[model samples]
Target: MPHVSLHTPIGDVTVFEHDGAIVALDWGWVEDQAQTALLDRARQQLDAYFDGALRTFDLPLAPVGTPYRRAVWDALCTIPYGETRTYIDIARIAGGSPRSVGQANGRNPIPLIIPCHRVVATGHLGGYSGGEGLPTKRWLLALEQPEGALL
Candidate 1:
């Protein structure tokens, strides 16, 4: 695995790649300091994003998971930037029930790039993998939709 760590508004992000595609993107308060060519590019992009200069990520990712999980991740990327989708909505789109979508969403590896944070509960902000909990989730949603115009 090839890994790189970069800074972001949410803090340090560690992007791991396997066989030329990203396998995971993790958020942490601190990360093991190491640098790579890929890390440099990822850092640049992440900085751009946090600075509100970039709206989309253009990085190769290959998260390893079951077929269903892979399908879920693929469907997740279809979710446009600055938009939120309910678990039920994603369930119908992914051809599964809401509970299944929740399961898959919990397993999303590349969080921000895949944009799993864009999914919310039917009437509230949903869970987040990052340790900061709902506040982090709320902050991310706010970053994507600063005016509270999430739909």
Candidate 2:
């Protein structure tokens, strides 16, 4: 596996590659960095995303998870940038309960790329397991918000 870490608005993010596909993205920098063409592209895309120049990611993602979790993650990806969906909405799409959908969301290995922050609880923001937790999630959601909109 090769990994590259880069600075972002929220914090340091490290992207991991396995078998030529992006496997995971974690908060904080890694001590030993391994750069590859794929990793470089992922970094560039992430930079563009944080800069608000890119709305969609164009990378191969191979997040390891169970079938159900994969289904949940696929549903998460359907959530458009700058928009949000309730956990119940994901459950409806993924054939699971709200709680199960939330669990899968929390377990997502690729947070920003998978767009897990776009999944919210009904009437409120939900728990986030990446970066600085709720604050990071809030920042990500705000980043995608339409310009001039209130955060």
Error of 2 at 28 (Å): 0.8
Q: Which regions in candidate 2 have their CA more than 4 angstroms from the true location?
A: none
Give the clash count for model 1.
2
Task: Name the best candidate (by lDDT).
Answer: 2
Q: Candidate 2's residue-wise lDDT over 1-151, tens digit each?
A: 7999999999999999999999999999997899999999999999999999999999999999999999999999899989999999999999989999999999999999999999999988989999879999999999999988975
Q: Would you estimate the TM-scores of all the predictions?
A: 0.87, 0.98
Clashes of each: 2, 0
Worst 10 residues of 1 by lDDT: 28-37
CA-lDDT, candidates in order: 0.77, 0.94
Could you tell me how far off, in angstroms, the CA of residue 89 lies in candidate 1 after the best superposition? 1.4
lDDT of 1 by residue, 1-151 (tens): 5677766677777888676667788775344555666666777877887777778888887888888888888888888778888888887777788778878988988888888888888888878877477787887777877564753
Candidate 1 residue pairs in clash (backbone atoms < 3 Å): 22-61, 22-62
